[model samples]
Target: MMNPFELERYFARWEFTAPFLLSASDTEPLAMSELLRLASPEMSDAWANLSLGYTESTGHPLLRQAIADLYTQTASDEGGEPPHAISSDDVLVFSCAEEAIYVSMRALLKPGDHVVCLWPSYQSLYDVARSIGADVTLVELREEAGWAVSASEIEYAIQKNTRLVIINAPHNPTGSMPDHDTWRTIVKTVEGSGAILFTDEVYRLLEHGDAVPLNAAATSSPRAISLGSVSKAFGLAGVRIGWIATRDAAIFRSLETYKDYTTICASAPAEILAIIALTNWSSIVSGQEAIVTANLKLWEAFMSDHESLFRWVRPTGGSVGFPQWLGEGSVDEFAENAVQEAGVMVLPSSVFRHGNPRVAMTNNFRVGLGRKSFPTALDRLGSHVRARYG
Candidate 1:
């Protein structure tokens, strides 16, 4: 049986009700009008003339082309190799990134195969594999180590029967990205072991400061899969558009077939909006980056002021950061109190507990810096912490 999704359940209970939500991972969302304004003349016409009928099961042709363009481009300026350009045929659209993860896992993994996953991940990364009867090993990202990905540990974890290796860059919860050398080493390791690599890249292109974005994994290897969504970086969660890109023709076909069993096709309107957002990708992402950059500065000051109550390792990328709680009570109790007393919702580490018995949970909690309201939320949390902890 598939395990419960505790993180989402916690959000279901508190996300709407909380007065100050400091645990959201996506960048601030855009209004429909704002998004439309960003659309090209051709896309605007498509949206204006859009039919409400079912979309192509694969995806809108234009949307697939736009998504293919994303992976075709490389970040060689960031010191990575030029990607092997992928065409529309290499892209597969899903209703959401969660669906993409589910469909891909169901199609690629089988009973008794070994899988290695990064710890404190979005649960579905490993859980779906387990649901299919695959053996999983979670390599932990420790708070003491600033939550860095350990290529050596990942290499060590792979076994002869390993079929898949999963990793999230600009990782959820922690927001730490691996250095280029480390990332390359991991890709090469998985390639040598004959295991397919699945990289969660929803948080790509949101790297802050001196941190540069890594090349898309699909560009690196034929068997590698790159998962992307407009929710996090483009703030289009309401549209529910996401996709998977790969150079492996067989895996692409497998994912396409499995998608038929679930949401056979994406929402017609969502695909139109996603095309606009992705077509104007640079500008939309720039807006999000501005908000994240400004909010991160506020968090820096807040963390400095309350350094005694939390062990903070500043996140290099993404909108979320996991900090170790140093207060007298457990983080669960503290988070509960924050919600009840301050109407602030924070994700305690318990929500991220790994299914593996050998992997221990930490005292960390996630804080989000992506939304425009983050500064105000930080103020509320800071006041609450000082009033209660001091």
Candidate 2:
């Protein structure tokens, strides 16, 4: 049996009950009506006459095409040729990104296989590989190093048995993203080792400031797989739509077969909504980015005012960031008290524990930077910090 997912379990207990979910990774979600309003005439008509029957296991054709367009657009921006463009056949939809991870790992790994993955990440990234009896080497990103990924570090971790290398950009919990050259090095390293590169791009298109989104890995390497979802960047978490894009036919067939045992298809309405969101990708993502930009300033001011109590490697991308606790007690205690007394829910580093004792993350807690409610949440947290830490 697989181990319990601590991060999700914590949120399961507090997410709906908490007054302020200060550690949520997704942007403020869009309402159904708001999303519907953005749909094209063709999609509107499809929604009006939608069937509630089970969808094709491969996903809706139009939905797959729309998702494929996302990769193609990014490829084109990078001066890619037609061969680099992702087609609908290269995209396979999953019930959620979590399912995509689970199914993909199941398909690609076996006993004695070696996997390399990032730490303080979504647990499913590594845990599923372990459950399959694969040996996993975690390349831990350090807070002292600004939570950065070192290509050399990853290069050293590769073993002859390594079959997979996983990386999440606009990383969860910390919001640390690698520079373009570093990303290229990582891709090259994984490719040279003959390992499949599985990049979690769920937070793609949410880059802050002048940072442009990286070209989809599926577009650049036949051995690379890019995972994405409407949950984070598009702010449609409730829809439960996510997909994997890859140019590798053999692995694509394996993932497709493995999916047969899980959710055969996604919800019909959710698929329709996802198509609408992807079709208007720019406007939807821009709105989410606007929230992050505004809330980032609020977070900066809060951090500045309470500089003695916390320190963080300011996040350059994504909607969430990790901040270290500089107070007298454990961050776990502080997080518990914050929710019970301050009505703010912040995730402690304990929730990200992956059974690797070498990584000491007790000093950190996650804070989300994309919510419209972030300002109020930060105020509540600030008040609590002063009352307790002082």
lDDT of each: 0.90, 0.90
Candidate 2 lDDT for residue 295: 90
Candidate 1 pairs with clashing backbones: none
The regions of model 1 sitting more than 4 angstroms off are 77-80, 356-359
Residue-pair clashes per prediction, in order, are 0, 0
Question: How far is 135's C-alpha from truth in model 1 (Å)?
Answer: 0.3
Name the lDDT value of residue 63 in candidate 1: 93
> Residue 383's C-alpha lDDT in candidate 1?
86
Give per-model TM-scores: 0.97, 0.97
Predicted structure 1, TM vs. truth: 0.97
Residue 18 of model 1 has an lDDT of 98
